[model samples]
Target: PGPGAYGLPTTIGYEKHDNRKQRMPQYSFGIRTNVSGKDAGPGPGAYQVDKLTRYGKGGGLEYTMAPLTKFKDKGFGPGPGAHDVHLKPMFKGTEAPAYSMAARHNFNFKKCGPGPSAYMYDINNVKQAAPKYSMGIQTKVLGKNNSPGPAAYGAGDLNLRLNRAPEYS
Candidate 1:
C-alpha cells in the first residue's frame, strides 16, 4: 500500500528491464542564445534563456567585386631596364706571366698621339690603369609571362639608353 498503490491488490506486480542496454544515450540537452545581442546583460554572462537582437560592431559585408587592371606607369624615369649585360673576351694576352697572378698584369691604352712621341711610352700596368669595360647597348621588356623581350628596346623590352660615353675613350 504505497502512496499511489494504496488501493492496489495484494498480488500486484510490475515488469523490470535494463535501462543501460545501449552504448550511447538516446537523448541529450543543449542551451542556445544570442550572445552578441543588444539586451545582453553584464550579470550572468549571456545564457540560453536570454532573448536579444544581435548586431555587428562596424562595416557589414560588401556585395561588389573588384576587377584586375593592367599596370600603369605614372612617373617619368627609365621604364623597365635590360636584364643583364653580356661580356665577350675581346683581347687575349700574349705572355703567360703578363696575365698571371704573380707578374704585374698591365692593360695599356696607347692614345693616338702625333707621330709616336719618343718618350710617350706610358706603361699603363694593371695596378696603374684599372681598365674599365663596356657592353653592347640592348633593351629588354618584361612580358606578361615575366620574361625578357627578344628584341632590344622593342615591345615588352627594357630600354637602356646611353646619355654619354666614357671620357678616356
Candidate 2:
C-alpha cells in the first residue's frame, strides 16, 4: 500500500464459511534481499542504488474493523467483506520491508467478486466473526521514515501547502 497507482490488475479470493484465520505462516524465519542498481525499471525502483536486505520471523493478522455487535447491527456477516484490518510486518529492510497474507470467512460468504462487493449483502442473517490473533516480525525498512532519522515527516512538513494535492477539498 505505497504511492503511485499504475493501475495493476489485482485478484482477490473469498470463502463461504466464517471462522477465519489468515494463511500467514504461524511461524517462519527467513531472509530477503532486493537490489536496486543504476536502474531497475521505474516507480519503487526509481530511487535505487543499494541492496536492501533484511530477514526475521513474522506473521499476519486480520479482524473485524469494528466490534461484532456493531458489524452485525450494520447487516454485515463475518464474511471477507465485513471490514477487516490487514497487516504484514517484516523484520528488516532499508526504510521498510513488507509482507502479505489474508484470511476471511463467508458466514459462507466470500467474494473476490470484483472490488469490495461483499460490502453489499449484510442481511444480518449470518453469525459474527470469531476472534482471531496473529504475531509477526518487524521490518526495519517499513519502520524507517525515509527522513534519515527515526522521525517521520509527511507533506505537512517543510510548510508544504495542503491545497497543492487533490485531497485538499
Candidate 3:
C-alpha cells in the first residue's frame, strides 16, 4: 500500500546477437524489493515487492506479479507511501499479505510486424522498449497465498493490445 517502506528495483533485457539485424528485441525482466520496519503497519517482518517481464519477439508475451495486501475493506485502502494507517476487515479477511502473478503470451500483437531498421534503447544488444503491436493471450491470478482477501483467484484474458515506442520528438 503506502510507498514501499524503502524500495530497491532492478531491470534487465536481452536479445539474440545479430550484426545485420539491429532492431530485433526479444525479452526483458524486472524486479523490485522493499524493506521497511513496518512504519507502525501490519507487516513489520513483511514488505512489498513487484516484478514484470515483457517479450517483444514472436508475437508478444507479458508477465506481471505484485503484492495484494494492506487493504482492510472495500471502502478504504493504504497509500503508496509510508503511513500509519491500518485496515482490519470485519469479514472475509485474513491477517496475512500475498502477491499476485499473471502471464500472457500470443502472436497477434506485432504491430510493427518487423519494426523499423533502427532500435530504441538497448543494453548488451537488448532493446529497451518494444515496437508497436505487442498483444497476446493474458492470464492473471491474485491472492495466491491466501492473503487478506479470497484464498486465490485467476483469469484467462484473451485480448489484443498494442505496443508502441515513445517518441521524444
Candidate 4:
C-alpha cells in the first residue's frame, strides 16, 4: 500500500487494458511509413498512394456530400443572303383567327440570323419570269372574308395559304 497505493493501482489497471486493445474499433487496410533524413527527396520510393482508414468507439460518425441545374439553344435556319422567308402559324389550343391573302407576286418575310437551311425561292413558270422570285405562303385564321374587290386586287382581311412552295428546276 505504498508504491502508489499498491504498485500504482496495478499499473493503472494494466495501462487501461493496453489502451483498450490498442484503440480497438477498426476496419483497417493499411500502409503507413515515415522516415525523413539525408535531405529526403523521394530517395526511398514506394509511391502508389490511395489510403483511407477509420476507427470508432463509444458513439458516432457520419457524412455525405452532391452538386448542374438547365440550358437550351435550338438555332439554325436563314442563310444565303436571306431577305424574307418567315412564316409562323402555330395555333394548337385554339385562338387563331385573322386571315389575309393576295400575294400574286410581291411577297416578303424577314427574321434573320441562325442557320441550318431555310429561305427558298423559284416558283414554276421558269421562276415566274424571275422578278425577285415569288412563291412563299403561310396561313392560319379561319374567319373574315369581306368580299368586294377582285380585279388583281390584293388587300387584307386574312386568308393567305401555302406554307412553303418554291424550289423548282
- Predict model 2's lDDT versus the native: 0.48
Model 3 score (lDDT): 0.50
lDDT tens readout by residue for model 4, 80-157: 766533555565534445556954433333434545576565668665564565488756655446444466566654
Residue-wise lDDT of candidate 1 within 14-59, one digit each (tens)? 2232343333433438666668776675666545443433652334
Question: Alpha-carbon error at 138 in model 1, in Å?
Answer: 13
Error of 3 at 120 (Å): 18
What TM-score fits each model? 0.10, 0.10, 0.12, 0.11
Per-residue CA lDDT of model 2 for 1-169, tens digit only, reads 5776565433323333223434332333665444755455566656534533354322444466876663345344465665535554454433444444865323423343565543667656456766766698756655444536544445455336544545454
Candidate 4 root-mean-square deviation in Å: 37.9
Q: Give the TM-score of candidate 1.
A: 0.10
Report lDDT (Cα) of residue 98, candidate 1. 34
On the 0 to 100 scale, the lDDT of residue 60 in model 3 is: 45
**Regions more than 4 Å wrong, model 4:** 1-5, 8-31, 36-169
Off by over 4 Å in 2: 1-128, 135-169
- Give the winner by TM-score: 1 or 3: 3
